[model samples]
Target: MKTAYTAALSMLAGIAVGAVAIEGLHAQSTPKAYVVSEIEVIDQGAQNAYLPKVTELIKSSGGTFLARGGNIFAVEGEAPKRVTIAVYDSFAKAQAARTSPEWKALAPERNKAIKVRSFITEGLPN
Candidate 1:
């Protein structure tokens, strides 16, 4: 009876360890989300007014910019006037940032400043 009890306890411990290992691996492999924007400035004065406010909103929404209107050389197709790339920890978070109230509030000002084409994509696992 004692031997059987010991074996059962050992099996339970092994199962618990396996479960933890799987969870850890899943967490480590979770993919990130990237937001890419192609912008064309229409009104310089309006764009200047819109920049700071949008920047602040992005930062407040827990996004980190990978690129913000730097030099671009297109290999095949035409390059956009400007490009912006930001990354979030997860796809859900990225979507939330775009749909947030703060972002919505800035839309009119942003539209007045620039024409923007944007998309969100899931990145490879970290």
Candidate 2:
């Protein structure tokens, strides 16, 4: 009887450990956020100069570019000339990256060169 009781307790402990591991995996697989920007360049020369500075700033803030300067085919409405998407760990991180001082300083040049509409959206879970 004692041996049977010990085996049952061991099984319960194993099940509990497995449940905790699954929870950890689910947390790690939580969806990230993307910072999407649609840009229309008014002055190509100024836009060229502005691009590198903001690119570096985004990298420094732990952002990864998922898409940059890609052609867009809009079926519903007018299409944007250029689109850039940057993925960060979370929505808050994406917001901080855009609002960081380094990025802010480069904003005027970017604004002068291009009209930008930027927003953040939650990414699909892996």
Candidate 3:
């Protein structure tokens, strides 16, 4: 959980930094700055343990968990798991958090405990 929160805080910080960068770029007539992260989490039968830790991590980082799988509206896969999508302010910060020591500490058990898919994207002005 601490890891997620760290990432979230990083996201918030990154957004703030991006805003500053964007404002400066605008002064020079540059493009806007933005970052997007799509994260998916899967666990067959250990949500009880996985969620609590993740919850703690998210809370610490000031991350808002956008969606968590609720009452089975539908099932398309054979895997029994849920998905959690969280949005951070920017890709840079999110990546930083993911690679940070705090998050790395959780790595030892993270892989065995759950499956995580993360996508980081930066938005360019059209």
What are the Cα lDDT values of the candidates? 0.94, 0.88, 0.58
- List, residue by residue over 43-123, the lDDT tens digit for candidate 1: 999999999999888888879999999899999999999999999878988999999999999989999999999999999
Ranking by lDDT: 1, 2, 3
Cα lDDT tens digits, model 2, 60-116, are: 898999999866899999988999999998777888888888888887898799999
TM-score of each: 0.78, 0.75, 0.49
lDDT of 2: 0.88
How accurate locally is residue 21 in candidate 1, as Cα lDDT from 0 to 100? 100
- How do the residues 1-126 of candidate 3 rate in per-residue lDDT, one tens digit apiece? 999999999999999999999987664542222222222444545545666776677556545566666534445655334555554545555566566677777765566566666554544543
**Residue 1 Cα positional deviation in candidate 2, in Å, after optimal superposition:** 35
| TM-score order of candidates, top first | 1, 2, 3
* lDDT top scorer: 1
What is the number of residue pairs that collide in model 1?
Answer: 0
Q: List the residue pairs that clash in candidate 3.
A: 1-53, 1-57, 2-57, 5-57, 5-61
Q: Model 1's lDDT to the true fold?
A: 0.94
Count backbone overlaps in model 3: 5
